[model samples]
Target: MRIMAKTDVFIKARIIKGYSQRELAKKSGLSHAYISLLERSVKSVGPATAKKLSDLLGKELEDLFRIELL
Candidate 1:
């Protein structure tokens, strides 16, 4: 079994919040490239970075990402 990343959840949350990647990047103090990579699932976010994103999105960290067994 493999633990899949739920980058889609993050993307959906961002869209629902009406935030562009660049906007979120500015608010979260993360680079737009990093946000892009995260949404694309090319890079995994660390706990600190996840916290920053969740805080900016007004969501709980758990709601931002989930693990799925595959």
Candidate 2:
């Protein structure tokens, strides 16, 4: 699995939406820590988790997976 760099745009968007990590975790059916790890680029999300998160974030899976700094 590849670890992608964290994107400010993504994090900002989520924050601006007033989404708490626990809320996002509930909405995406992912663990809060797992989501945190992914956002920090400490871990990579698999297909299923990516799809769930993308859907929750209203973003495409490809967009979510993109590491703009790479």
Candidate 3:
């Protein structure tokens, strides 16, 4: 049996909150281009950015960002 890997729910939460990328970025004090990178999983979110997004989107940190162990 195969299991699906857990995915970040950032886009879903952003949609549910009815905010466009630009809007969310402005609200979260980030740039829309950066937000695009985040949504696409092209960039990893740091603790500070995660906290900003979590508080702004009213989502749990784990729900929006994944912590990768090095």
Candidate 4:
């Protein structure tokens, strides 16, 4: 499977929302390492994770992660 996270959008949104990766992890109940992987597009963001980020960053799921199962 391949995941193409819109990392630029995600990072910008996170910054605009006043959250560093660690802060976002804590707020969203995700691991910092996992957040890092997501941001780096090294791992696919699961649905639950996508929901959490979308809720926290006020970004739509489509804008953040474009995960396509191969």
Q: Per-model C-alpha lDDT, please? A: 0.79, 0.70, 0.75, 0.85
Worst 10 residues of 3 by lDDT: 1-10
**What is candidate 4's CA lDDT for residue 11?**
90
**Residue runs of model 2 more than 4 Å from their true location after superposition:** 1-6, 67-70
The residue ranges of model 1 lying beyond 4 angstroms of the native Cα positions read 1-5, 67-70
Tens-digit lDDT string for candidate 1 (1-70): 2222367888889999999999999998989998898888777777777777888888888887664444
Best by TM-score: 4
Each candidate's root-mean-square deviation in Å?
Answer: 3.3, 3.1, 5.7, 1.5
TM-score of each: 0.79, 0.74, 0.84, 0.88
Candidate order (lDDT): 4, 1, 3, 2
**lDDT per residue (tens digit) for residues 27-53 in model 3:** 988899988888877777767778888
Q: Cα deviation in Å at residue 70, candidate 3?
A: 1.8
**Which candidate number would show the highest lDDT if scored against the true structure?**
4
Q: In candidate 4, where is summed lDDT lowest over 10 consecutive residues? A: 1-10
Those runs of model 3 whose alpha carbons end farther than 4 Å from true positions after fitting are 1-8
* Residue 18 miss distance in model 4 (angstroms): 0.6
TM-score of 3: 0.84
| CA deviation > 4 Å runs, candidate 4 | 1-4
Clash-forming residue pairs, model 3: none
Question: Between prediction 1 and prediction 3, which has the larger lDDT?
Answer: 1
